[model samples]
Target: MTIAVLAVQGAFIEHEKKLEHLGADCIELRRAEDLNQHYDGIVLPGGESTVQGKLMKELGMFDIIKSQIKNSMPVLATCAGMILLADKLEAESKVHLQTIPMTVKRNAYGRQLGSFHTNATIKGIGEVPMTFIRAPYVSQVSDEVEILSVVEERIVAVRYQKQIALAFHPELDNDLRIHEMFLSLCK
Candidate 1:
């Protein structure tokens, strides 16, 4: 299956590499037109949500991605990408691609120095090591969303049908179970 990674900024390249290592065809998504290409799934990598949001507007991708999610396309948003997918953003004012009904607080894990890794039991993926780098946490989730993983009692990973929002960087870990689970959702 083909997976498109939003390459506007952030850890998109890393995500691409992980997907490729999983034997899935991966592509860098730049323009809104790129979304027109056939793809089974999409990944929004961790980055500055404000900047990425602006870039999406500049590249005319904001609406297209929103539409795609509305059409039931499978998507995985990691870290800042999770902020983008959230229905409510508690940071700077910007247009977020509200794909998931959740309220997100950017940098909920403190500053860069607060970044750390830990072993967590992720639903459907078992116990896996996760990297949280200035990550955001899900403050609230709708009834449709399922809590996939948690750390210190906060929601770290969640899924709403085909859409997955992960607060940590699964791509940074050696385990491909999360990515593999996402691939399975594509099928």
Candidate 2:
């Protein structure tokens, strides 16, 4: 299966490598026409949400990706990607795709110095390594969103339908379970 990793901004390379290691053909979606290709799933990597959101709009990729997600295409969104999917963004006024029914705080962990690494339990996925770099945490989730993982009493990972939103960077770790889990959803 071919997976489209958003290369507009952030750590798309890590995600692309992870998927390739998992035997999935990975494609870097650098432009709107890339979205026209037949792909099994999409991966929104960790990066600057504000910049990514802006570029997607100016480049005309935002609406197409949003429509695909709404169609139930599996999506694995991490860090800034999670912010992109959140319906309500705290501390920030802009709402990007507004796909997931949740509220997130931008830089909830403070500045870059607040970045950390931890082991957390994700529902059904077991314990895994999580790396957070200027990450945002989900403060509120609607009834439809399932709480997947939490660290220090704060929600870190959640799943809404086929879209999995994570506040941490799973691509930074050696554990392939999270990527495998997302690929399974694509099937």
Choose the strongest candidate by lDDT: 2
Could you report the Cα RMSD, in angstroms, for every candidate shown? 1.2, 0.7
User: Which residues of candidate 1, in runs, are more than 4 Å off?
Assistant: 91-95
Q: What is the lDDT of residue 157 in candidate 1?
A: 97
TM-score of every prediction relative to native: 0.96, 0.98
Q: Where does the lowest 10-residue lDDT sum fall in candidate 2?
A: 90-99
Computed on alpha carbons, the lDDT of every model, listed in order, comes to 0.90, 0.95
Q: Determine which window of 10 residues in candidate 1 has minimal summed lDDT.
A: 89-98
- Candidate closest to the true structure, highest TM-score: 2
lDDT of 2 by residue, 1-187 (tens): 9999999989999998989999999888888998889999999999999999999998889999999999999999999999999999987788999999999998999999999999989999899999999999999999999999989989999999999999999999999999999999999
Cα TM-score of candidate 2: 0.98
Q: Candidate 2's C-alpha lDDT? A: 0.95
In the predicted model 2, the residue pairs found to clash are none
